[model samples]
Target chain A: MPLDIPLIGARTALWLVAQIHLFLAAFVLGAPIFIVISEWLGLQTRDPRYERLARETMKVVAIAYSLTAVFGVLFAFVLMGPYQLLTNYLFRALYPVWALYGLFILLETVCMYLYWYTWGPLSATTVRKWMHIGIGVVLNVLGTIVMLLMNAVAGFMNTPPKAIETATLWELVNNAAWWPLNLHRFLGNITFGGFVVALFAAFMFLTSRTGEDRKFYDWMGYIGNLIGVGALMTMPLAGYVLAKELFLYDAQLATFMMADKLSGYFVMQGLLVVLLFLGANFYMWLSMQRIEGGPRFAPHMKAVFGVLLAGGVIWVVPQNFFPDLLSKAPPGVSEQALILPERFAFLGLMVAKALAVTAIIIMTFVTYLLYRRARATGRIVWGRIDPMAQYVLIFIPAVAVYLMGLMGAIRSLTRMDYHVYGALKDLTPYWYVVTLGHSSVMAAITTVSFFLLLVFVFWVGFVMGKAHE
Target chain B: MSDPGTDPREARIEAVPLTPGAKGGWRRVKGPGIFALAGLAAIWVLLPMVSDSWGIRFGAPYRVFFSLAVLGSALFFILLNWGPIPAPGSPLTTFASIFLVYGATVGGVMSFGLWYYPQFEIPKPAVEQARAQERGKQAFLSPAANCFACHSIEALGIRGGTRGPDLSAVGAQAEARKSGTPAEDYIRESIVNPAACLTPLPASGLAECLPAADPARTYPPLMPPGFKDRLSDEQINDLVTFLMGLKGLAEQDGKSR
Candidate 1:
C-alpha cells in the first residue's frame, strides 16, 4: 500500500516505536530470567540477600513488564499503519505463529503477575518457594517462546526465504537468518537485562543513605555485573554466527554490513563490544582493591588490558578510511600524504577485526579468572568502593542501549528499499536508504530517549510504591 | 507519624485477604472490563473518524485494530495490577485475563478485516517493480555499475568485452549453476564476488562461459568486485532484481538450439 501520513512520516514513527518496544521487551525478557536464577540461588545457598534481591528485582519486572506490553501494542500499530501490505503478506504467511506468540504473551503476563504478587505467599515454606521458583521458570519459558516467535518474523523480513510468496509456514520461519538471530538475541537479552539491572543497582548505590544500603547495593551491583559480563563474553561468538549466516544468505547484504557503506556501523559495533568488555573488566579490577590479596592479580591486569586495547583499536578501524583517495585531497599536495601503503590498511579488513575481537574476548575471560582467583585467595575487604566504579556501571548500560539501538537500525536499514529482502519492495515516499551519519544520529537519539524514559519509569514506580507504603 | 515496629508493606498485605468473596471478584473484573470496553469503543468509533479527519492514508481499519490492541493490552495490565482484582491475585482470573487480551486482539484484527473486506484482494500486481527494475537496468549500463563495460548482454546487443563471461542468459545460468541458489542471489553474489562460483559452461553451449578456474590470475579482476562500495543498497537490490529477469533470453536460446 502507498503510505502518506500527514505529520510523522510512517518510517520515522515505526523506527521510534519499534526501538523503544524492543528495549522494553528486552528488559521484560531479561528480568524474569535473572529473578528466577536469583531465587533459585537463594534457595540453594539459604542467603537472605539473594532472596531480597530477587524480590526487589521482580518488583521492577512487574512494572517494566506492563510497559513492555504497552510498547509492544504500539509497535504492532506502527507496523500495520505505514507498512500494511507488507504486514499483510507476512501476517498471512505466519499468522499461526503470530497467534501462538499472542498466546505465550498472555501466559507470560499471567505468570509474571503471579510470580510478583505471590512472592511472599508462595514462598511461605521451602516446599512452596520451590513451587514459586517453578512458576518463575514457567514465566521465563513463556517469555522466551514469545521472543522466539517474534524473532522468526523479524528474521524472515531480513533474509526472506526464496519464493516466500509460496513458501510454507515452516519454511518461512526456518529462513537462513532465523536461528542465528534467535541464538544471538537469546543471549543478547540476558546481557541487556544484566546491564539494566546493574544500572538500577548503581543508581541505588549512589543514592543510598546508610551503610547497610550502600553494602547491599554494592553486592547487588556486583551480581548484576557478574551475570552481564558472563553473558557479554559469549556474545561475540553468536554475533559471528549471525554475520556468517548473513553472508551466506546474501553476499551483497553481508558486504553492505561489514565491508562497504554500512561498514562504519560494524566498526562502531566493534568499539562498543570492546567498551563493554573493558567496562566489565575494569569494574572487576577495581573490586579487587577491596580484597586483601587482590593486589597479586594487579600485574596481570596490565597484560590483559594491553591485549584488549590493541584488539579494540584493531577491531574499530574503519574498513574504508580513504573514501576519497585522490580527487577530494588538497588540489596540489596529496602525493606524499597518500603514499601510505595498502598493506598497512589490511588490518582494517574483516579477518583482522575478527581476530582482534577474538583476542579481546579471550583477555576478558582471563581478567574474570583473575577476579575469581582474588576472591578465592583473600577475604573481600568490603565497604567504600570508589565512586568511579558506580559511574562505570552507569556507562555500561548507556553504551549497551546505544549499541543495541545502532545495531537495530543497521539490521532494519540493511533491507534498504525492500520491505522484505529482495521482494515486496518498499514503494513508500520515504523508501530512500538512510545515510550512515543520519542513522547513527537517530540511533543516539533513540538511545538517550530510552534511558530518559527508563529513568522516568523507575521514578514513577518508586513514587507509587512509596505512596503505597 | 508511622509505627516503627510495623512494616507498612507487610501491614497492607495482611489487611487484604488472600481470597476475595464472589462480589469482590466481580468488582475486580468490572474495573478491567470497563477499561477494555472503553478502549474497544474508541477504536471502533473514533479511529475511522480520526483517519478521515487527519487524512491518514493506508489501512485505517488495520491501524485502528493495532491501536486498540496496544491500548487493550496496556489497560488490561494496569487494571490487573491496580483494580480490586483478587487479593494477592488469582490464577483463574489471570488465565481469564489472558484469554480476554487474546480475544480482544483477535477480534480487533478480524474486525478490521470485516470493516475493510473489499480492500483485501489477492495477487495485487507490483507495477512499480517493473519501473524499478528498468532503472536498475540503466544503472548496470551506467558508469556506476558499468556491467556492460566488460560483460556483454547479447540479448541487449552491446558486446564490448571478452574479459568477463557473457551475461546474455546469466539469469537462467545462475539458477542452474547451484541447485538451491536463487537466480537473484546468484546474480547478487556475482556482482559482489566476481570470481567465486563462476558460472560453468551450459552443457547445451547456448552462452559464453567462464573458464571454471582462475579468471583472477589471468586478468586484473576486471569485474570490479566492490559494487557495494559504489552503489547504494537499494541500487544493488535493483540491479539484482533486474538481473534475475535475464532468464527469458536463456530460455529462448535453449528453444532455438
Candidate 2:
C-alpha cells in the first residue's frame, strides 16, 4: 500500500522530533549515573553538601524525565502515520523489548520519586540513608536497562545479520553492532547528563548572591564538569570502536560513509571533538582562580593550553583520502595535493587524530589532578574568578548543545537515503543528497532551537521551585 | 524538631567581619564584566557587516579566517571573563547575556560559514573506465541504491550473503544466463524487476534443497522490485559497470565466460 501524507513532509518532521527527543532521552538516561554517585558519596561521607546536590539534581531530572516521555510518545504517533510498514516490522520484532523498556521506565520512575521524597525522612540515620542510596542504585539500573533495550532496536537496523534462519530473539538482541552501539550510547548519555547538570550549576552560580550559595554552586559545577569531561574523554574511543564494527559489518557501506559524500562530516565531527576538549579544559583553567594554591599550578596551564591548541588543530585536518564528490581541491591544486604535500598533512589520518585526542585527554586529566591538589593544599578562594567566567560557563553548554546537534545531524544524514543502512532505502522525493552547507545550517538551527527550548525547561523548573517554596 | 536555618552557629557566622580580600572580590569583577559586555555588543553590531558577505568568491584562507574568528571570539570571552565578581543582576540577565553572546558569536560565525562556503557541484568526468568504476562503486554501496545489500563481492570485502548467491561472477554469469538477455539488460531487469527473472534458490528463500530438482523453482523471488522508478539511468549504468567488473572469484584467475 502506498503511504502519503499531506501538509508536512514525513522525513523532516520525524527528524526534527527525533533529534529533540534524543537529546531529552540522553539526559534522562545519563543523569541518574551521577545522581546515584552523588547520593552514594553523601551517604559515605555523611556530608549534607553531597546530599543537597543529589536532591537538587533530582528536581531537574524529574522535569526532564517527564518531557522525555512526552516527546517519546509524540515521536511514536508521529512516525506511525507515515511509516506504517516499517513501524509494524520493527514493532513486531521489538514488542517484547518494548514491553520490558516500559516496565523498566515504570520502575525507574517509582524509584526516582521515592528516592527523592524519602531523602529527609529516610536519611535521619546512616542505615536509612544507605537504603536511600540503594534505591538510587535501583533507579540507575532500570534506566540503563531501558536504554539498552532501545539500542537493540536501533543497532538491528544498522547491522542486521544475513542468516534469517538463525535470526532468533537472542540473535536479534545480539545484532552485529549492538554491543558497540550500547557502549557508545552508555558513555554518551553520561557525558550528556553531566554537561546538562553542569549547565544548571553554571546557571545557579551566575545568579547566586550569597557567599555560601556561590561556594555551593562553584563546587557543584566542578563536580558536574568533572563527570561530564571524564565521560567525554572516553567517548572518542567508544565511537571509533563503533565505527570499526560498522566497517566490519559492511566494508563497502563503511567506505561510502568515511570517504564519499559524508567525508566532510568526519571533518566536522573532528572539529566538535576538539571544541569539547577545549571547553572542558578552559573551564578547568577558570576554576583554578577559586583556589589559593591554584596559581602555582597556574603555570602548568600554558603547557596544557599549548597541547590543546596543537592537538585541536591537528585533529581537524581534512584527510579526504577517498575521492569525495562533496569536497573539492583548492584552486590550482589537485585533490591529492590538498590532502598530501603539506608537512603536517598526515595529521588528517585516523592515527594522528587518535594520538592528538589521547594527548589532550591525558593533559586534561593532569589539569584535574592539579585542581584536586589545590582543593587539598590551598586556601578556599571562593568568588575570586571574574564575573565573565559565568559567560564561559554558559558558553561551554552552548558549544556542547551545538556539537550534539551537529553530531546527530552528521550521524543521521551519513546514512544518505537509507532508513536502515543497506536494508531499507528512503524512496521519498527528498531522497537526494543534502549539501554540506545545508546540513551544517540545519544542525546549527537545531542546536540553537534546542538550547532555547532547554532554557525554557530550566525556567519552568525554576518556577516550580518557587511555587513549592 | 530543631530548625537548621535558625541555628545559633549560623547567626554568629553571619556577623563575622569580611577580610579585605573578600571585600575586593566583588568590586574587581564589574570592570572586566562590563568590558566583556561592551565587546559582545560590538560583535552584535558587526554581525550585519558579515551577513552581507554571501557572494564573495573567497578561497580557503578566508574560510580559515572565519573559523579562527569563531575560535578567537570564544577565547576572547574566556580572557575577558577570567576573574570572579559578585554575581551581578538576576538569573534572567545572565540567561539573556549568554543567549545574546551565543547569537552574536557562534550563531553569527556559523551563519557566515554556511553562507560563504561553496556547495559542491556534481563531477563532470571524461569517459574513462576508472571513473565509471569509481561511480559504480559509489552506487553499489550507496544506501539509496544498495546493490551491496543482496550480493557479495568478496573482492571488495562486502559479504552481502548467499541471499543472492555470490555476485562475484555475475559479470560472466549474466551475459550467459538467458537467451535474448544481454549483460546490461539482465543486470538492470534483475534490479528493477527481480521477481520476473530467474533468481537462484538458496539465496532467495529456499530452506532445503530437493534431490534431482531445480532449487531456483523452490523459492519465490526475494528482491524488492521497482528500482527503475527510483534510480536514474546514469546511476543504474554506473551500478551495471561496477557489477560487470566483478569478473568472478580470485581462484578463477582471469577466466571469462
Output per-candidate TM-scores for chain A, rounded to 2 decimals.
0.94, 0.92
Per-residue alpha-carbon lDDT of candidate 2 for residues A1-469, written as tens digits (9 for 90 to 100): 1233445456556666777788888887788888878877766666566777788888888877777777788788766876665676677766888788888888878887887788789878878878888888888888888888888888877776666335788787788779998898899888888887877877776766677776667667777877888888889889889889888887866776677766666766676677677777777777776665676776677667667767776676566433364556666755443443344456557789889888888888888888777766755554555555556566666666666766666556655555555555543334455656666666666667667767777678764565587
Error of 1 at A108 (Å): 1.2
Candidate 1, clashing residue pairs? none
Error at A337, model 2, angstroms: 6.2
Counting clashing residue pairs in each candidate, in order, gives: 0, 4
Best by TM-score: 2
lDDT of 1 by residue, A372-456 (tens): 7776666553434554466667778777877788788888878866777776666554566565455555666666667767766
DockQ, model 1, C-alpha based: 0.01
Q: Give the Cα error of residue B181 in candidate 2, in Å.
A: 18
- Indicate the docking level reached by candidate 1: incorrect
| Local accuracy of candidate 1 as per-residue lDDT tens digits, B49-116 | 65433433213323443454445444433332231123113435433443343234233323322332
Q: For model 1 chain A, where is the 10-residue window of minimal lDDT?
A: A321-330
